[model samples]
Target: MTAPRSGSILTTYRRHKELLLLLLPSMVLLVLFNYVPMVGLVLAFKDYMASLGMVRSPWVGLENFQRLFASEDFPRALRNTATISLLRLTFGFVAPIVLALMLNEVRVSWFKRGVQTLTYLPYFLSWVILGGMFLMLLGSEGPVNWLVQAAGHSPVSFLSNGAWFIVTIILTGIWQSAGYGAVIYLAALAGIDPNLYEAAAIDGAGRWKQTRHVTLPCLAPTIVVLLILSLSNILNAGFDQIYNMFNPMVYDVGDIIDTYVLRRMVYQDFGLATAAGLFKSVIGLLLVVSANGAARRLSGGEHGIW
Candidate 1:
């Protein structure tokens, strides 16, 4: 029995050899870029002396983490990061679903394709360029401010105010990412059986009924997967966007874990920066795991993210 099972495994592996060969380069890059750098996570627990080097660095237990816990900026930064993340998660989770549903309803092929192109275009723009454009449009003296003045309101300094910083981050995230993320939902929507819609319509169900019953139910699996993935990324508040858009005046509301680490690194506190990074990574791992577990329970033996 064991011999036959082993032979069967070998046969399946051999049959998929070409596919595995195709995946080799990506796996190699993943190991090199993603896995290999994990070794540096140990720096979090060490006193990284400039002259001592990494290997020669003295182990400092949890001193780095202790300092981080006691830092003046830690509490406020954590709150801001969590608030921004939650906002993005709420909006980000719904935008793609709505876009996918709307796209599916568009019967005109050309119009649908044009909308897709327009939506996806922003995803390709560099953060620096997009940030500058957004700043110009939302600046104190920009076109938006002009409109606000015309609307009988005072001009708002979007980039300078801590109160508006988090809102700006969430809005920019939606602008930048909603389209690219919608592609997966669009594909999922496509795979849904149109015959189900036809059947529902034949049975006297209107468009709303069809969408509520057939469309949403069919798309539930994809939605669950996407939600899990999004939740797992609670810590990842888009470093590139936040880093490029943030100013000193907005740091109280805009500084996230990633930006904080980068700041510490630039200031030459390698050990503390590494500790903060490690803290974020550990929380991120727990979140993903918990999300996967919740998915399994909710889906009840259907395909899970794990």
Candidate 2:
């Protein structure tokens, strides 16, 4: 009995040997790039002078966190980050699903492919280039403002204004990411059985009704998974986009946790900067856990991110 059991185990391991070999590099990279750096989180709670170094430095429990929360700019930055993130969650989350539905309805494969290519191109462009494009279109004398002022109303400042920059960030966030997000729904659409749609149509269901009753219900699980994953990053708030487009005039409405850390890093306050980084990471961890727990409790679905 023991010999047969050992033989079965060896046979199973041999069957998967090739697949395991292929995955070995990625597992190694994950450990080296991701899990290994977690030790540096200690810097968040320590006063690291060059003389004392990381390990030898005296531990200062929560002093950095205390200073961080006490700062006036931190609250304003938190609000700006939250508002932009919520707006992105609303529009950006749904925009791709809508795009996918429209794409799926396209009878012509070529047209669908063309639409996919056009939308996906923007996702690859760097934020620096996108920033330049927005600047040209929304600048003080740019064509968009040019047209606006060409009409009766006075010219509005796009960059320097706080409120408008918030809108600009949200719109740009959608533009850069929506198409890529659509690719997931497109794959989900491909999984759906065409027989379901045919049956609905035979039952006299119209296009909108087919979408509402058939497509949406089939897509509900995918939507739930994506929503749970998105909730994990509710605190991110697109640091690169905001950093490139914003200036001192709009920091109150545009600054986020990442930008705050970057500013302190510039001043060479490594301790405070590390604390802020750790804070962002910890909040991200809590949000994901809470979101995943709620999802599991409500749906009894399996989406353990860990």
Candidate 3:
């Protein structure tokens, strides 16, 4: 019996050998890039030194975590992260869905394609390039300020001012990511059955009614899944965007956990920075689990990461 079972396992493995071969590189990369680096997370608990190296670094237990929480900047960074993330979750999350729905409703293929192309172009542009463009556009001597001056108004200091800085980050973030986000929703929309729409129409339902009854219900699971995923990254306030676009003036509001960690690293407080990063990761993990659970309960177990 044991020999036959072993033989059956071997046969099954042989049957799917080609499929496993196809996945080998990706599996290797995942292990190398993702899993291997996870070992470095221990740096958070250690007093790291370049001379001593990771192995020789003395473990300080929770002292690094204590210092991280005690730092004045830490609270500010945490607040800013939560604020920016929540704002993005509320506003930025909806833009793509709305755009996707509007695009889905468009009957003109050429026009819809053109609009999609235009929207998607920005997502492909690195924040490094986009930041420079935005800086130029938002500068006092830039076209935007020039227009404001022309209108007999003062030129607003967009990047310098705290309130405006947050607004600018959120808006730019939406612009950069919304199109890419919409692609997922568009795919989901495409997967909806045409028969449902036809049935709704047969029942004398208008476009809005059909959309409300059929489209939205079908989209609910996708929306829930995406929302849960987004919740997991609530601490990540686009490091590339903020690092490139932010100035010292707006650091009070614009500095997120990532930038805070970068700043700590600049000061050579490796353990503190690592602790902050680890804290962020822990929070992210907790948020993911909680959000997944809530989504499952809310969706009657129909939608969740699990």
Candidate 4:
């Protein structure tokens, strides 16, 4: 029986050999880059010393985590991360859904295509470029301020002010990401059966009613999945964007877990940095599992990433 099962497995693999070959590199890369790095998570539990190496490092248990919690900066960074993430989830998440809906309603092909192109262009550009551009444009003597002065108002300190910096981060995050997110919804929209729309119209449903009833219902699964993914990354809070755009003045509002970990690594506090990273990963995993369970329950097991 065992020999027969092994032979069947070999026959199945031979039948799908081409597809398996194509998947080989991706499997190798995933193991090398993702799984291999997971071994270093043990650094979070050790008093790591360069001379002693990872295996030889002295175990410190939860000392790093205790230090992490005791640090004055950790709480502030946690608060800021949660605040920014919620804001992004609220506004940034909705922006793409709205854009996709609007684009779906557009009659003119060229106009719809043009709008998509313009919106998606920013997503392709790095934060390094966008950050510099924003800094220059929002500077005291910059064009935005020049326009404000022209309107008989003072120049606003967008980057320097904490509240204003949070606003800037949210708005810029929406601008950079909304288009790409819209593309996802657009693909989902494209998969919806046209017959549903036609049936709705036949039943005396207007465009708005059709959208509210048919389109939205069809989109529910996609929305739920994306929401789960977004919630799981609640601690992320756009590290690259904040790191490039932030400064000393806005640290109170803009500093996040990733940035805090980065500073720790920079100062050669490897154990603490690893602990912070491990904490974040653990939280993210928990969130994903919780969100998935909740989604399944809410949707009667019809929706979720399972």
Those runs of model 3 whose alpha carbons end farther than 4 Å from true positions after fitting are: 1-33, 293-306
lDDT score, candidate 3: 0.92
Candidate with the larger lDDT of 3 and 4: 4
lDDT per residue, candidate 4, 1-306, as tens digits?
Answer: 344454577898998899999999999999999998899899999998989998999999999999999998888889999999999999999999999999999999999999999999999999999999999999998998999899999889999999989999999999999999999999999999999999999999999999999999999888987887789889989998999999978889999999999998999889999999999999988998998888888778877779
All candidates: CA RMSD (Å)? 4.1, 4.1, 3.4, 3.4
Q: How much is 89 displaced in model 3, in angstroms?
A: 0.9
Best by lDDT: 4
Model 3 poorest ten-residue lDDT run: 1-10
Regions of candidate 4 where Cα sits further than 4 Å from its true position: 1-32, 293-306
lDDT of 2 at 188: 88
- Candidate 4 has what TM-score? 0.87
Candidate 2 per-residue C-alpha lDDT over 1-306 given as tens digits, one digit per residue, 9 for 90 to 100: 344454576787798899889999999999999987788789889987879888998999999889888988777777878888888999889999999999999999999999999888889999899988998888878888878888966778888898888888888888888889899899989999999999999999999999999999988988987788788888899988888899999887888988988998898787888998998899998998988887776567665464
Report lDDT (Cα) of residue 10, candidate 1. 77
Ranking by TM-score: 4, 1, 3, 2
